[model samples]
Target: MLKRLLLLLCLTGHVFAKEPPDVECLVVHLKYVHCSWNKQGTPEVNYTFYGWFVIIRDSADVSECPSYLSENNINTGCNQPCGSRFNSFYTRLVHENQSSKEKEHELKTKVKLNPPTNLTVHYGSDSNLWLSWTQISSNCVESEVRYRINNRNWAVVSIGKQNYCLNLPSHSSLYELQVRSRIGYACGLSEFWSDWTEPVVWGSNNSTDPNKMNSSMSVWTPVLSVVGAFILIVLVMMLLHNERWVICDSQTSHTCCSFLKDWFKFPEGLKEGLNYNERPCPVREYCHVRQSDSESSDCSTCSVTTDQTDCSVFIPVNESDLPTPCSSSISQF
Candidate 1:
């Protein structure tokens, strides 16, 4: 009886002598997992005796008992009990795997952008529209942005540095512009589009009636040309009229008279009186003779004798050579 009791006490002592399983510390590194054993036993005994472990599973939630076991051998004293050992290790493994999966999911997810602000549109001289806006954030860069005009095709633009400008087509049609920014690789995340910029309508001033300007220009051109031609004709006529009456007053009147006399032939009598060679004839009815004071005339056919000369014969003389004549007349036979 004493031997049996002693054997039972030794068996109980041996069973309880195994140290309790510890909670494992699983460390996550950049690309790998590092796990350490933390047990209630002495450091020297625990360090080399327990092996680090890991388990990969698909499911997010599962009971701790059925999941998996450590590939490394851990000496849990000589008894090697099963249930008490696995709880801490299993909990930590499940937690570490969940954490790693969550981190990977987050990395794969894309970023997003806020809506654009202070949007404006302007018309350029080339009949094109220019669209501009302020940056949504400071992290915008590269060809990560794209746009659409009026829900048409998407046009990519470089957003590596922020800010964007869009050139619109040449037309007066109203357009609805939509802009989106890429948040992650391959446009993983995008932003809500901005409202249309007042529906910019483009076209020429006379787009509705294109022919009106051409007609107006044509009419005015002919009218102006006719007016100019008329003015030129009038100026030429005036110049010609003035040239016809141009006379030099500084010339003598005698020269004018002489020119007129040469231009037109006069009657024979008028020509004879103006000629220098014609002698005065006494028989002519309209003839006059002049005598000098120092001279005397002697006539036999008529009873006329005086200091003045009788009109028996006449000679042509200049008016300067004539003396003062006495008042008398002779009767015709």
Candidate 2:
């Protein structure tokens, strides 16, 4: 019986010797979010419960002691309670990593402004343009908004908050505007950039017509003036002729009789009652008169009362006479 007991004790020792050492913590997977670790030990073993493990080395002088090897060590969990706090804790880690890598990274991130909504462009005075947008999200800690001209180098316009009023150099050039979310890394490696907006082309207030500056003042102005003057003359003459005559004497005076008698009467030496000499009047060469009543003689003057009246006389004048009419008239009874 004593031999069997000794053998049982030896077997127990062998089993314990084969058992693997318990790890205080283990690093499993890594991502932007939570990292996992396992604490392995017997339940009775004393455990400080360090949260995570990171590979670290000591750099102290140790000539008197054996050279210490660099080893993975477990770090204490964040002072705060666990839970969603892991997100905040992870973020802090990321920030630290970024600060360290900054020496090697070429690009830097700056949050000029938060994400803007309802972005719009407007033309300002002095032929300059302005861009305005609304702020919606402010997820970034330090943020900046960048602008590019024709998709060249990105130029940072403003930082923190959404409203940016950029004074464009010229209203004639086109522009492309976009927004991005900058985390604690290089600019290019940050979260995906927002989709590019439609191009906004600038416009000019100047007239589009090329001839507007070089057009002659007299060409159109004088033509319009002559047309207006002719209209006025015709209107005034019609108004005057429309006046009714009060005939108190032996002869009733018509509209044409007064105009003709005052201007074109024969000289006093002519016989009082002889038939008028019907010479080919020189005025006839230039002016042709048509009487309203077809039976009336073409030489007799006809009266027109309404503004709509057709002229009874047509004159063939040279282009030089366009500004004036009736430079000459023949005397007649």
Best by lDDT: 1
* Per-residue alpha-carbon lDDT of candidate 1 for residues 237-289, written as tens digits (9 for 90 to 100): 46635875333222343454345346444345544433333222233222233
Instruction: Please report how far candidate 2 places residue 4 from its true position, in Å.
Output: 23
TM-score, predicted candidate 1 vs. hidden true structure:
0.23
Please write out the lDDT profile of model 2 over residues 120-203, one tens digit for every residue: 767677545566554433434224455665335777754555445566555433455554433333222243234333444344
TM-score of 2: 0.24
Q: Provide the clash count, candidate 2.
A: 8
Error of 2 at 227 (Å): 38
For each candidate, what is the lDDT? 0.40, 0.37
Of candidate 2, the 10-residue stretch with the lowest lDDT total is 99-108
